[model samples]
Target: MTHWPDRPICAFDLETTDRDPRIARIVTASVVVLDGDTVASRTWLLDPGIEIPEETSAIHGVTTERARAEGLEYTAGYAQIREALCEAWVRDHIVVAFNASYDLTVIDAEGRRLGLPGLATGLVFDPYVVDREMDRGREGGRTLQAVCAAYGVTLTAAHQAEADALAAGQLARALCTRFPQLADLDIMTDQAAWHAERQRNFAEYLSGLGRDASDVDPQWPIRGIA
Candidate 1:
């Protein structure tokens, strides 16, 4: 069997208006394509048209004023993002995202908000879930920065979409190097099962604590409006 890293991968990431993926507007996005070592990237900054709260702006360094002044219109920016992802998939590259669910969810939501058809995020690889599954006993944080550190991949610009996307691709390469089984797994099928199992376990845990788990989405890669 061939190593997954030998194939093309489109690593994606988004900087958003807030933490809620369902409603948060995309402030910036990056799609980094990796074929072996050769790399190409596309990035976008968009005016979300909603006020970016200072607290959220502090994270990705895109204040509402700067966004309005320098960024593309939200619809145009999101259209470019969608087109890039579609082009990557059409080229047979699997889309890779750090925590795919959140990023993809934002994409789905944004597309719907713009009255565009939902994008298919089925053929996607999520290093975050794969790492958690493969190394269940690993201590400490599982954030992009922490995981990159664990894999000896330097993540220079922490919250920026372009830097994060490139780092995610590098991290995926590291994981595939460490666990050949991960490279063999079918992301569309096997990963859906894995994500469902993870969600089920999480829901059960929440249920034990008397918290409602009914709204927990089991969708892998992307989640649409519930």
Candidate 2:
């Protein structure tokens, strides 16, 4: 499997220590590689340097002692994940996520924590933003489950990293099926252009509702938006 598919993609998700990407550490992460239609995957549980908060633990269920005994030591696990994601990115394969900014930011922050470089540079696809753009003028939406329902994709396990990523990737496929607007995207789509276009569409949609979604994503110094 040295060569990739015409639609080389990977659906991935990460569980972290907190909500803030700058400080949150990765507790676990998974990558489901997609070669055209077939899939292969690998996942990792890591010993995040900090104690996992009960609130987050309640969500993903990795406890302190359990992780220390069972999970890979933080540095090695982090390095492996970083290497895997970077390898995929280098191959021009797109990494798909639901709310991509949150996950990707956490990854970057985690890299700094582990003394490793960022895994993904710019090529990524986000189903959440795509759904919002497609369902403009609709009310009571913007969640992964909601979007999946809107597109007639069934919801499986929610918040489980691997499940969510797989669902998001499927949702992306459905969107391309119905909309055909996002068919050309890949994991290496430059964040600057990607985020800018998404910001524009989202802002207009929100303004139509007299609300502001401008601050939805933190402004980062993206390398290649134009």
Q: For candidate 1, write residues 50-72 as lDDT tens digits.
A: 99999999999999999999999
Q: Would you give me the overall lDDT of model 1?
A: 0.87
State the TM-score for model 1: 0.94
Misplaced by over 4 Å in model 2 are 1-6, 118-122, 184-217, 220-226
TM-score of each: 0.94, 0.79
The prediction achieving the highest lDDT against the true structure is 1
lDDT values, one for every candidate: 0.87, 0.72
